[model samples]
Target: MPTIYLSPSLQPFNKYLTTGDEQYWMNLIADDMVPLLEQNGITVKRNTPGTTLGQAIRESNAGNYDLHLALHSNAGPVNLAGKLRGPDVYYYPYSSAGKRAAEIIADNLRKIYPDPDLVSTVATTKLAEITKTSAPAVLVEIAYHDNPQDEAWIRNNIPLIAQNLAMSVCEYLGQNCAL
Candidate 1:
């Protein structure tokens, strides 16, 4: 079975504009993905709540994982608050495998995100999760939590989001999964 390190956001302080925090929503999606991941013949290893990103990176690097998937919701900058929507799947600029994984995730995410045109795969040299792990990594900013419409969309579609994410992972792992 292909093993994946599933790191959901640990930032409970990044509250959504509506009623929840990034940590809460990200973990809910991660929690839901676990069973589906296992059923699809993938081994899932995840970071615990309250752990730091450094700790999660260390744990993932110590493991023999095929991929490292970090789940998070986005927030717009101060001046741009509530103006952005859609997912941004990020990967290290120099890693081909990471870029491919990120592209696959972004494409799959477009199937569910409100505007397919808004879903993008971003390449960056920063972001510890994308640079420090042993496995190919993709940190997906699932949606803009600071936007009311996006927050409402996320709150109402947890199951669909989870299933879509799981399908994305399965596809990345070369496993067949129907949405």
Candidate 2:
């Protein structure tokens, strides 16, 4: 079975515009992803809510996982707060596997997001989750938490988001995913 290290945001400070914090919503999505992945014969190792971001990275690196998927919500820059919208799936610029996974995730997200063009894949070296892990990694910023419309979309479609993400993982792993 392909194994994945699922790291939801550990940052409790990133609050959604109307509802829960980033950690809360991401964990709920992870909750939904677990069973979907397991049913498809994938092994998932998740980070604990109490763990720090550094610890999450350390633990994920210690495991022999095929992929490291980090779930998070975007927050715009101070000047652009509440103005930005969309999902940005990020991968380490140097990793081909990471880029492939990010692309697959971005493509799948386009199907559910309001504007298909808004969903994109980004290459970055700044995020620890993507840079420090041994396995191929992709960090998905589901949507802009500061934007009410985006926030509401995420809140209303948690299960759909989870399903889409799980399917993306299956695609990357070359596993057949139903639903």
How far is each candidate from the true structure, as Cα RMSD in Å?
1.0, 0.7
Candidate 1, residues 29-70, lDDT tens digits: the string is 999999999987899999988899999999999999989999
Hey, what RMSD does candidate 2 come out at?
Answer: 0.7
* lDDT per residue as tens, model 2, 1-179: 79999999898888777778999999999999999999999999999799998899999999999999999999999999999999999999999999999999999999999999999899999988999899999999999999999999989999999999999999999999885
Inter-residue clash pairs, candidate 1: none
In the predicted model 2, the residue pairs found to clash are none
**Lowest lDDT 10-mer window, candidate 1?**
170-179
lDDT of each: 0.92, 0.94
**lDDT: which candidate is best?**
2
**How far off is model 1, as Cα RMSD?**
1.0
Candidate 1's TM-score reads: 0.97
What TM-score, over all chains together, does every model reach?
A: 0.97, 0.98
